[model samples]
Target: MSKLTPLGSLPYPQPTDVADVPLHLQSLAEAIDGRTVLRFTDIANLQARVTNPVAGMVAWLGTPGRLFHYAGNHWAPVAPGPVHKVNNNEGSTTSTTFVETLTSATGDPMAVSFTAPPSGSVIVTVGAYTYNSAADGLAYMSAAVRLGTTVKLAAHEDRSSIVRSAARVSASTQFQVSGLTGGALHTVTPAYRAGGGAGNTASFDNRFVRIDPVT
Candidate 1:
């Protein structure tokens, strides 16, 4: 009969029974420690476990392949895995609001602003809504992702559809960019110009933007 030593530590502290040997080994595969095991748990449960966590504590979450490590403050995915971060503003209004400074209350930026990870690249998704048949009774909208003043992604509605105002429309697009310096700030925005319609005098509604990084 033999007992087992603690995990990740030196060998034996003579066990009192041979029967416990198989049980201890079974637990080793199921738990993180002798008392605590973390396998497939949701993000909420994962956060609850490490309420007073230290740096470098890691666990598999939500599924077998989803591994996360707890840094001092938050949980970060294990290396070689994609990391996602999102910033968005929501509300309702009836007016022409174009991209400007990041006045979230008014949606001046019309996009999500974020700090780039050390990866120097990220993918951005832009979403927005607007209603304006004002100009030529047609409404047009455009969107872009920018690394500082340099535009990385941009798109606009065709004049026929956008310029001729209908009901509000969901404007969404995505783009990937590289060569950015990690830890830099990036922004995405919505815009309108003289495209398919003279609908420059239209109105706008809800808008949002998001960015994801794959390193």
Candidate 2:
């Protein structure tokens, strides 16, 4: 009698069966033809070798050490993209209108730029240590995450005689932007503003921004 392996169903001949050696060998060879991951030097090599790849077929590229799988129409990476982070602790704004946070004395905005993946969303997070100069009445400080001229996320906190004057508070905002243009460069910026009183000031320090891409 003969049975088949559980996974690939390769032929397994019993000792009592006495099957022909050539027949068993041919069956095994046919069953194992496309059972292993195809290896190539790079994407070009993979494309040259595999012209008619079916869905679920996987290939390993040597140059970048990435695994790709065919999705019936295109090949996609198995791993997510890398994360980007930037930090700055210089400069402050007192305007009531939202503006880019400066990272340097020369007025460089606290911004981070990265390339967006072909088909995925990006998550942006901004955080800072906030300060309001006014002690009496209500004072508010707002922080926002911006992509170009668009504001992705914004949040504000009010401090009205809650604690001692000039106390520092933490303000942060996070947003996920989807349907981004593939292979496009994206710049994320953090902004801040102040309101609720005359001669009041809002300041930010120890600012940080992070970007993550999901595919």
Candidate 3:
């Protein structure tokens, strides 16, 4: 007779039991037969080792230190990845065409880059302190969050004639972008434009862009 482990049901001989080599071998086989998680150096190593992983199989990736679970056809992250953020307060613009809110002295757009998981989604949040130049009609500032050149979220603030000219306001927008290519680098930028009126200068300061990858 023997006692068995509560979780894995592994058998161990008791004081009263006779020598049981077959039972001991069976217990050893069971111990290593079904592992809860497999460890690998990285994604390339994991794919090389696990060519035909089944559903619900879990793996630990060493390079990025993340956990992944196989979901029948593809490997999915067990949890959301790290968040990325960028902040700038040095630039202002009055361009009617949408342009980067943060830019270098060389006129290059400032951006935040992050790696996305396979078929994953990211939540993007963009915010800025905005100023609109005085005008007889409506004075407005329009801002947007862009994934590369594609605009994902856009927001605007309109100051009416009664609200005083040259008003400063806070504009922000948050949204999710999905269907991203797995293990690809993605960039996010905050952009702005002036309202469709003459002398309606739109300027932004103290702006930030945050990206949160979702599993």
lDDT of 3: 0.62
* Candidate 2 per-residue C-alpha lDDT over 97-144 given as tens digits, one digit per residue, 9 for 90 to 100: 666654242334656765555574777666666666775422233334
Off by over 4 Å in 3: 1-34, 101-122, 135-168, 176-187, 212-215
lDDT of each structure? 0.52, 0.61, 0.62
- Candidate 1 residues 124-186, lDDT tens each? 555456445443454444556677888866544521124345466666556666676554556
Q: Rank the candidates by lDDT, best first.
A: 3, 2, 1
Q: What is the lDDT of residue 176 in candidate 1?
A: 68
**TM-score to native of every candidate shown:** 0.43, 0.51, 0.58
The backbone clash count of each candidate, in order, is 5, 0, 0
The candidates, ranked best first by TM-score, are 3, 2, 1
The pairs that clash in candidate 3 are: none
TM-score of 2: 0.51
Runs in model 1 lying further than 4 Å from the true structure: 1-105, 134-140, 143-164
For model 1, give the 10-residue run with minimal summed lDDT. Answer: 95-104
